[model samples]
Target: MKSNRRQFIKISTLGTGGLALGLSSMNLNGINAAYAANKNEAVSDEDLTPYPTYCEVCFWKCAAWTYVDKKGEIRKIIGNKEDPHCNGRLCPRGTGGIGMYHDEDRLKNPLIRETKEDGTQYYRDASWEEALDLIADKMGKIKKEHGPECVALFSHGTGGKLMGHLLKAYGSSNISAPSFAQCRGPREVAFTATFGEDVQSPERTDIRDTKCLVLIGSHIGENMHNGQIQEMSDAIDNGATI
Candidate 1:
């Protein structure tokens, strides 16, 4: 290696202007090996913190692992291998959840629209107190003019539970969700009409031990319920007919 460096210097001295070529040609394994050896030794377990969490982007709530670096920044997200629902596997949306924490454009505070005399309106950031006051004033006027039931809600699953409770407290029964009309709404309405009760989310049906399975309007395989998928696979393996 010493002789090789001396020869390279002699070549560079010959006006070849191949300094970059000399460096590129030189073996870097020794430096790389030393760096690799010290890499783990440089970081103690105390520097890295792994937090067990879950995805809230959807109703699934697949278990996840959030790794934090020594600087206290979230480094990565990994699916929890022990989670039976997803088995350490996450969907595309779940994998992109780190954006929820680190996105620069995310709303950090309230915003209100400021209108120009020319009929143009632009939004500007506002304080939480001012925003809540405006909301309360508007909602109070609506409740006085109409009824609380006139206030409707179209929300994602469970995310609007607090708002739902608030609406109910205000004597409003017009709360609704997209999940109702698209997925569970029709089933809930039918089930409630027949059974006199609301069906629970992710309906508890044991497909594994059952002898036969009858899917009416449901495409169970495409439903994306990991537990149900596992149970269905088990039922099929145990010779249960669909």
Candidate 2:
């Protein structure tokens, strides 16, 4: 499965440059500058500190330098220039990490339910002990009644490591990720069959140094992938073919 996925991505890359160009143009700077500036100023590091980390916005897992305030709050996230993949550039989604972490509607605690009935859902704040106990109990019941094979686990990108461990420990073989079905599955499959090797990211394309970029369906100006998008802009500014 892994080999097939890699092949598909390789072929797609040859043609995707065009598609990226088109996508990048639509919404690249639609964000209001004043609003963005105000939001930045409002972030307080007293709540969290920007820890040097990485982002999982896409499959690349770009290295990031995060600003965590004195209070342990994450104030901002920017790509690490030292990282070979992103090189100090970040997509809008990654730049918006502060909003995600501070979102009021986000789940902050474990939830347990006695039944699946609507409105019967009662949430109680739980300690780690309580949460683990509940999970273990449920897993035991599930294994005894439905068998371990009945369970399926789905996750994506980098943070899936922990979930992968949990699934393996639970003895379920039904694990899947949407990367193949959603973004790069077709490209990967094609590349693997033809070449017998996967094209890991930070793919060989050195767009920053390229003389000409032929974009097929990719909207390069709009859908932002930090390094690629920035290179496209520089190419245009320097009058390189798009």
Candidate 3:
């Protein structure tokens, strides 16, 4: 009986080890199958032509130099010193913005989800024309049922202006944005209460000429508002207090 138990334990251990080995081998085979071709393709600066453009990562639109290889692969993005927003510097978000274009999993086409008879949903890629036509038909049906004001938009930053325009044209006064409510709302209220009007976006704080600055909760450098931080640096250089 002891001999039989020992044999059983040995067999169980060997079976577990064999299963792990098989799984590892299958994973390696799957990886090899997925990357059968060379996966180390790269573009160098020497093979790229640099073109000046503006970043859309944030509302700032920092001027940037984009380097595109002959095959139209973007190799890099750098700040253009001429642009005041960047002052020749880019934040981490701006520097990493290239991923938006080069990401392998980024959506390239519109998708329409079709509900299967069994309650499963499957999405199919669609052309721009087809997607737009479907949206228009649905929107028309909605407007007929309710009203144009039923549509509301919550947008962000400068890129959102086009959508705002479209919504307003479609008779949507119900638009709202939390970006305004949270990020800039307090500043607007403060300025309006004190000065009878609020300053434009960016607040245009003359940090370079200020004698003293008091920070409440704002981590200026860490907030990544490039222009303000640059001006704050200049103010620090000119011997301004915290």
Q: Can you give the TM-score per candidate against the true fold?
A: 0.61, 0.64, 0.69
Candidate 3 lDDT: 0.71
The model with the greatest TM-score is: 3
Worst 10 residues of 2 by lDDT: 1-10
**In candidate 2, what are the lDDT values of residues 37-136, reduced to their tens digit?**
3455465445555578888756667899887655444556888989777788776667765555554444688766555556465666777789999889
Candidate 3 segments exceeding 4 Å error: 1-47, 185-203, 208-211, 233-241
lDDT of 1 by residue, 161-232 (tens): 988888898888887787668877887888788778877644556787976888887755454565565577
Candidate 3: residue 148 lDDT (0-100): 92
Q: Which residue runs does candidate 2 get wrong by more than 4 Å?
A: 1-50, 68-75, 113-122, 189-197, 215-222
Stretch of 10 with least lDDT, candidate 3:
30-39
Which segments of model 1 are wrong by more than 4 Å?
1-47, 185-242
Judged by lDDT against the true structure, how good is candidate 1? 0.67
Name the lDDT value of residue 184 in candidate 3. 80
- The alpha-carbon deviation from the true structure for residue 116 of candidate 1, after best TM-score superposition, in angstroms, is 2.3
In model 1, the Cα lDDT at residue 59 comes to 79
